[model samples]
Target: MDETVKTPVRSFDIHDILKCLPHRYPFLLVDRIIEAHGDQSCIGIKNVTMNEPQFMGHFPGHPVMPGVLLIEGMAQTAGAFCIQAQERAPDAPPPLIYFMTIDKAKFRKPVVPGDRVEFHIERTNRRRNMWWFKGRALVDGQCVCEAEFSAMLVDTPTA
Candidate 1:
């Protein structure tokens, strides 16, 4: 009998997101996943707020979401996709997704507190344990940031 079991694709709430990725408060960026396609794409939501640590120094009094964090949020969305993919095989080892490279990054507008950022990420390529994705962050349907990035899925190192 086969020991491997494939995990299915599904939506994620904050609790679910926590289970899929290893990030926590202050660094955990994604608020929830609205939809996801098997190893293909994911759409996630982020609720920005003035209380977020970055805003305290990123530019006090004029809170703006850092471009890097926007990219990070996009990356997190991709990470969730990878986690869901691994679920497809129950016996498959849980993999840690690492940001490998980022390119073609563009920030079109400043993201401010109270903005609901939507990260739209789609797989571009996958070779072995490495995967490439194109991502975009939008607010009110307007693009605020976009980039192409790659990540590697590997077995978590023993402590």
Candidate 2:
């Protein structure tokens, strides 16, 4: 007999993310996540705007999104994956994911103002505390950046 299986999709609003990550506005590259599957994968959103500080001098006449921000966005998505994965386990406090390696990073195109950058990441492997992920960022369905990175899961200590 075949059993029907469904992997529930979890959503995280800005408030939920704030609790998971120690980042604030102007630095919080990821806005929200529409779908999350613990340590497997996730889809995230980032609203870009001209009001961002880097736009001031990133280009005198033209404002271009920085590559570092793109990587940060991916990192945020990976962080979300780790956080959701831990919550799905038996019972646990908050988990803090830290970037261990960021490799094969490439910037293919320019992400400008008024653009909504979407990020998709999948966990390739998770051993003990380290997690490996392959991620890509897209704007208007066009790839803007892509990379493979690894991070460590460090649970926050409870009092």
Candidate 3:
């Protein structure tokens, strides 16, 4: 008889995300993460609002979440997942994750205000402290954007 151990799915709220990532407001894109399975995959939610700073200059009359920001959101979501999945010493500082590459990025539709954008990310590969992910930004269950990206995790420098 063979018994397989399964990793339990985890979820992260804004506070938990704050602990995992270093991003703050005006840049922090993911509002929450759900169905996270030990960095294998996770779905991140971002609520687009008219009050966002980008709307002020992105367009004078119309407000649309920029495609670049969408990609950044995907990267942030993946970064948070990588951090949360790792094991570290209790006193160790959170690792700093840097965006390394964005590839095969395609924008299908413009993300607008009031849209609840969900970033679905799946890990494709991982080497040492680097990880690669395939991500899709969806709105109301429809795909709005997709991309493949990579990030590297580095330890924080001691003061």
Per-residue lDDT of model 3, residues 1-159, tens digit only: 769877799999999899989899989999999769897999999999999999999887988899999999999999998899999987788899999999999999999998999999999999999999999999999999999999999998899
User: Clashing residue pairs, candidate 1?
Assistant: 5-90, 6-88, 7-87, 7-88
Best by TM-score, which number?
3
Q: TM-scores of the models, in the given order? A: 0.89, 0.90, 0.96
Per-candidate clash tally: 4, 0, 0
Q: What overall lDDT, based on C-alpha atoms, would model 1 receive against the true structure?
A: 0.90
lDDT (tens digit, per residue) of candidate 2 on 22-87:
778878899999888756889899999999998999986899999999999999977975776674
Model 2 alpha-carbon miss at residue 97, Å: 1.8
Candidate 1 vs candidate 3: the TM-score winner is 3
Compared with the true structure, all predictions reach lDDT values of 0.90, 0.87, 0.93
Best candidate, lDDT: 3
Q: Is candidate 1 or candidate 3 better by lDDT?
A: 3
